[model samples]
Target: MKIYKILNNNAVVVKEHDEEKIVMGSGIAFQKKKNDIINRQKVEKIFVMNEGNEKFQELLKTLPEEHIQIAEDIITYAEGYLQVPLSNHIHISLTDHLSFAIERHQQGFQINNKLLTEIKALYKKEFEIGKWAVQYVAEKLKVQLPVDEAGHIALHIHTAKLGSGDIASTLQQTTIISEMIEIIHQELGMDLDEESISYQRLLTHLRFALTRIESNEPFQVMDPDMLEIIQTKYAKAYTIAVKVADYLEKEYDIQLPSSEMGYISLHIQRLIT
Candidate 1:
């Protein structure tokens, strides 16, 4: 592909099939001008723009080559580990976060993540990946990143996985899920078996419930006979579900309709049994 624009000595914008793509490698654009044919052997990474190229071009201008390269490596590793395709925008977000994180660390300013505990509990796999990324960044940059930064990185990964790109909302959902799990533990007087199918089912149910709550969507009302039967059959679980609803109402100002309560009670019952 011929270079359409040069981002730097190591990076260039190329057009293929009438689409713009950012290509990068060591000295890929050295002494190259627009319309020059690119040497494919030197290219290490290619970023296909999903929204617009302007933001990426801006990022390339300000971020160092090492930071960008590290971000790309982390994203690639995360995709392989998670076995899911991350949103293309992760390249932009991760690079920007790393750049800021490095600057803050250099200037002796450390940022704390208030949701660190919740992030670790709710997003176990992603948080583990984030910790690995932190170590990777530290070794590569020769600067130690604070543990809290792992939580921040996990949030970015979670947001990308959700494809929502809303960090605040993703964090809220995590906090909610964590709180629910805590309630379950407290009410059941035992730790959950994380590897069990029941726990996975409950976790999935809670995730979707949080999504609906965030969207202000109420669950469909259940038939009175069925609701009564569920409430009576799973009395303890129903009570726990009520406690969860109370927590949601008090903490998030979200009301759990009776319809939602019935399904949540079922999931809780499955966990206990």
Candidate 2:
């Protein structure tokens, strides 16, 4: 790949096979000029132009080298753990978030995540990785970040896992799932085992349900016979599902069709048993 432009001593815009890529590493672009062939050995990370050149360039201009490196490390670890490729936008969003977080910590300003509990409850694995990230960032950046910041980082990973660029919607989904879980717990008069397979299944169900709700997809129609059987057999679970449906209707203005109720009640029955 040949250098198309140099962003800094450690970063450069390169072109390979007629496609633009932003490469970064320690001294990767030092003394390099446009049209110079890049030394692949110095490259630490390569960001494809999956989002857009303009947005990538803007990030390259303002994001510090350390911040970018930290984001890259986090993304690498998350991808391995998730067993899925994350969206390229995480490169930008995570870096920006880390940069701002570091700045806030330095300025003695701490922002609390109002959805911290919800995020932790809904995204357990990601939240654990986020906590690890907190320690990693602290050791590397020599600054202490609050536990709430871990929740924020978890949300970023959650957003990447969903492949959705809208952080707001991702957060809303988290909130919705957490609220539903709380409702189930309250109605059942018990604390849920977060590590239980049934709980995990419930979370997966809510995750996709929120996706459908957000995308305005119509729910599948259920057979009256099956719906009646489910409602009669798992009356308690079906009642809890109704509460969840009512919450969704009031909060997001999305109705849960009978099929949704059946699925939710089935998951609830599994959890209750």
Candidate 3:
């Protein structure tokens, strides 16, 4: 890799195998240089930058548009119903909330009413950004995201609502597990065997799953095909977790992706195993 243009000391424009790409860093890689060849191994962290290039721009442009619109909708909905902002109520930070909202739209789910009504009512500025975020995802990913999937996805993407202020590779899996635990805990009401090492291990795995999502790291649990393991070993937990997810979707007016939910349910099963 060669330094095409030193964007900053920590960052530079380097082509990957003769391909044009955008890169970012904390500082400029070169003081005054263009077309300075560099090694891929030498570069620290490189990312694909979206510069609104015509061809690629066409894809992501709509995403921001949709994001802003969605935010507006959320704001309006909240003001009309809950009279508060979802962020204020949940203490959900803004960055993660927007990220997850875009992702959920990418995966094809709709935002729901419960928090939607509140978000719109309180955080008008954040809601504006949220709407823009929806559009950004739409255009950037070239995925015409639906509005319904915006709210929960936004919540999941927002580290504020989930736990941290960032997303992990295991985010989808983490959301499922977190929601499952909340549901089951509500029902069982501290009945889980706290003294049992098995219970502790299960909680550990669940936490790990969430960390993965926040770090954008691959999920370690389902690295192998463990769905069967869940089904065979902890059938009750798996069944209960999934059922609770479905019930929440209906009762609370939130969207829960089944595939993501199942991943968490599988981890919950590990608790009993």
How do the predictions measure up, each by TM-score? 0.75, 0.79, 0.29
lDDT of 2 by residue, 1-273 (tens): 888988877888987787888888888887879888888889888878665666767877787778777778888998988888887778778888888998889999977987786677677888988998899998998888999999999988888875564788887777778888899999999878877888888988888888887788877778899999999999999999999999889988978887899999999999989
Error of 2 at 260 (Å): 3.2
lDDT of 1 by residue, 174-246 (tens): 7788788889889999878877878877877888888877677776788989999999999999999999999
CA lDDT of every candidate = 0.85, 0.85, 0.48
Highest TM-score: give the candidate number.
2
lDDT of 3 by residue, 200-230 (tens): 5555555554455446776433433556666
lDDT of 3 at 180: 51
RMSD of 2: 3.4
Model 3 quality (TM-score): 0.29
Cand. 1 Cα-lDDT: 0.85
Residue 121, candidate 3: how far off, in angstroms? 35
Summed backbone clashes in each candidate are 0, 0, 70
